[model samples]
Target: MSALATVHVVVPARNEERLIGRCLDALATSRALLLAERPTLAVRVTVVLDGCVDGTAAVVRRAPGVDAVHVTELSAGGARAAGVARARDLEPDLDRGRTWVACTDADSVVPAEWLVGQVLAAEQGAVCRVGAVHPELGPAERLLHLGWLARHSHAEGHPHVYGANLGFSLAAYEHVGGFAPLACGEDVDLVQRIRAAGLAVVSTGDDPVRTSARRSSRVRGGFADYLTALAVDLARAT
Candidate 1:
């Protein structure tokens, strides 16, 4: 096999000036770690900037082991779709069987073993893998999320979907017509589509991504807004 596998990472960032560096650093480290273990495994990262007005692009441009792509009017889904295409184009052959497309948000930091874990799963026959996203919350926010967790317990084979920490085979992705253009819930939409096509989309709890807990989210009614609304409701109940 050519280099065991080739993994491409895609990150969608709008104005993540504060968090892009950390995110990129973590990803760069993960790539190095994976290469160290499996020297033949190829890896590439693309940071897709969507109409950013801050230093997100600047940070990514200087970052090692990553490519930057700027777009005028792209959100979460469109940005990632654009990134996927760009990343694949960089590869010499773009072997569909050995190629993997992974995604994480610019506001999140993946673990050092993030990419390695995904590659392991893929090597063991996992077509799609979705990792968990833990918000960097404070004491109050943690307690608030506790109630939300009661109903959303992490169990084996849980269908929790998040674009910030998900990956799929190249062939499977193109087969699904690529990612849809949605402001939010694009991750879930893509997962559902993959499953509907009779593909295996499973969850892996190891080395879950750490995301921001800011109430003012990039996408309205997203994870951040969900936490804000929950906090409001809980405070009212108390």
Candidate 2:
């Protein structure tokens, strides 16, 4: 028999004032839904304001369900690492075997079942749950997003890394020494290490996160760049 574990969510943001409100709203809704399903489950959220010179902090501060809000100058990987540390510090009694760490972006909206799905995966012996992400975009970006989806679906193999929507048990995360301090590719790096260590990494295919499709993003080389590249390729093909 497996025991229910606490869920610690980390969101690292940089100048995401415009999207932070929506992100928090979606997360609060998801938390409510998760609590309804498992009244006794413990879920906490930490929003790290990475170099945010905007109202992102205020938004998180007023959010009803968030557990912590940290301000820092780091972006991408550094910000994420800080957020995870905040979660760890806030819960000093957290047991690696029973607690799970979940991560999402400031510009993304997750479904109500996001935490529930991750907890269930952990309880079932999965060390990590790599989830899917859908793009929220305009018409042009939507076309590119769909194209990417189709291309990925028919690609040679499935993706092994996705930071926007990812989760892992604390034990596995600690074993890999957590996210590195790079500005990009932290998600890929962490997952590669976990896989290299022979941890049980599974797919949370059903709960795809809704992430922004804007070309301008916090991370320099990320999904935004991929979409922009696809758009460029599309223009060249025309």
Task: Evaluate model 2: give its lDDT.
Answer: 0.80
RMSD of 1: 1.8
Q: What is the C-alpha lDDT profile of model 2 across 89-148, one tens digit per residue?
A: 887887778878889998899998888788788878889888888778666466676677
Clashing pairs in 2: none
TM-scores of the candidates are 0.94, 0.92
Q: Where is model 2 more than 4 Å wrong at Cα?
A: 154-157
The residue-level lDDT of candidate 1 at 82 comes to 92
* lDDT: worst 10-residue window of model 2: 152-161
**Residue-wise C-alpha lDDT for candidate 1, range 66-159, written one tens digit per residue:** 8888897686788889999986678757788778888998889999999988888787777789888887877756677676676455565877
User: Whose lDDT is greatest here?
Assistant: 1
